[model samples]
Target chain A: MLRFANPTLFLKLVRWLLPLAGGAGAVLLAWGLYLVFAVSPEDYQQGATVRIMYIHVPAAWLALSCYSLMALSSIGSLVWKHPLADVSAKALAPIGAAFTFLCLVTGALWGKPMWGTWWVWDARLTSVLVLFLVYCGIMALWTAFDDPARAARPVAILTLFGFINVPIVKFSVDWWNTLHQPASVFRMGGPSIDPSMLTPLFVMASGATALMLALHLAGMRTEIMRRRVRTLSQQLARQDGGS
Target chain B: MMDTPHAGYILASYLLAGVIVAGLVLLAVLDDRAQRKALARLEAQGLRRRSSGQTGEQ
Candidate 1:
């Protein structure tokens, strides 16, 4: 992993990995969508509305996972001073924010049909909202400084601080009385859902994970190039000043 | 797939997710391309990046 701290090595790795990740994501998502819309039987209670689970659950899961990745990268940046760690953290912020936004929107869509309201101020929903706001704040903090290098420490510290929200978001329903349902798929007894439903959920989740991986590589590639551009321009400025 | 009692909500959720995910992918691709292009342009201007191991032909 530390060997990948070299930008050239990282770039070479991503060049091939991006296409592989993208292709796998496409195939899995296609298969997952087919299973979701065509094969999985409707819930007797929720009917067709339950199909929304395919998108909502994966979005929510990925949202949390992305934040976890960012926090880990933050630690890497602060402790190891890993070259690419800050780039990874910076790159993940918007992707995580986007996923968090999707989770909220899809949850609202699911909530309206099943719970008779678009939203409720319950522990689960409220904590996820807080997580989303933290995502936004983190992103804002990334650009809050002119020098990206100077921005790194604050961003890392804030990310570490903000990580408290992740567990809160995950266990809120279980810990408190809420309109949201308790964990069905990841509880102590294991997933209580039918195999048919569980299969598509995993497939869709794999696809989403692959997609995030592809985007993450692309984002890091962009950052590396952007850093090069900044360096080159700064060198040119210094040369001009000296001349 | 669109004839159910709450099909609209389900469809909307999927559609929104699709749009957001696609938009993110598109943005990442475009940003990568733009940066590469800028770097190439800088190289073309005889400005070689130090330590990138590129021999820039002026």
Candidate 2:
């Protein structure tokens, strides 16, 4: 993992992996969607609205997972001072934010009928909102600095602090009396949901994961090129100044 | 399948997810293409990367 910190090597790996990720993501999503709309039975309670779970759960899970990844990258940046760590964090922010944002929106849409409200202040919902805000804060911090090198440590610290919310988001329904449902699919005892439903959920998750991988790889590649451009422009300026 | 009372909400959720995912993919692809183009342009203009060490201009 550390060896891939070499930007050139990272780029080479991304070059091969991006297409595979994208292709697999598309295929999984198609199969997942087919199962979601055509094969899976509706929730006895929620009716067709349960279909939203196909997207909402995976997006929510990925949102938390992405932040955890960013937090790990932050630790890498601060401790190892690995050159690619900050780039990984930066590349991940908007993608994670998008997933977080989607999760919120989809949840709200799903909630309107089931909960009879579009929004709520429940522990799970609120903490997830905070998680979204943290993503935004990290992204804002990234652009706040003219130099990414200077931004690394500050973002790293902020990410570490924001990470306090991840577990809260996970266990919120349990920790507090909330409208949100407790874990059914990933509980300690084992999944409470029917296997038919569980199958589509995992498949959708794979699709989301692959889609994220493709985007992250492309973003990382772009960031590397952006850095190279900055370096070359600086060197050109230096040459001109010397002449 | 589409007859459920909550079909609208389900559709909205799926549509929103599709849009967000598509938007992210577009941003990543565009950024990658733009940066690669910029790098190529810079190299064309005698701005070689230090590591590459292949001088583009005399």
- Which candidate gets the maximum lDDT versus the true structure? 1
Candidate 2 C-alpha error for residue A83, in Å: 1.1
Clashing pairs counted in every model? 0, 0
Provide the TM-score of the second chain in candidate 2: 0.81
Return the lDDT, model 1, position B19: 96
Clashing pairs in 2: none
* Interface DockQ per candidate: 0.59, 0.59
Q: Give a tens-digit lDDT track for model 2, residues B1-58.
A: 8898778888888888888888888877788778777788878887767576443211
Give the per-residue lDDT digits (tens) of candidate 1, residues A35-148: 998899899899888899999999899999999999999999999988899999999999999999999999999999899999999999999999999999999998898778
Please state the CAPRI-style docking class of candidate 1.
Answer: medium
TM-score of each: 0.97, 0.96
- Candidate 2 Cα misplacement greater than 4 A, ranges: B53-58
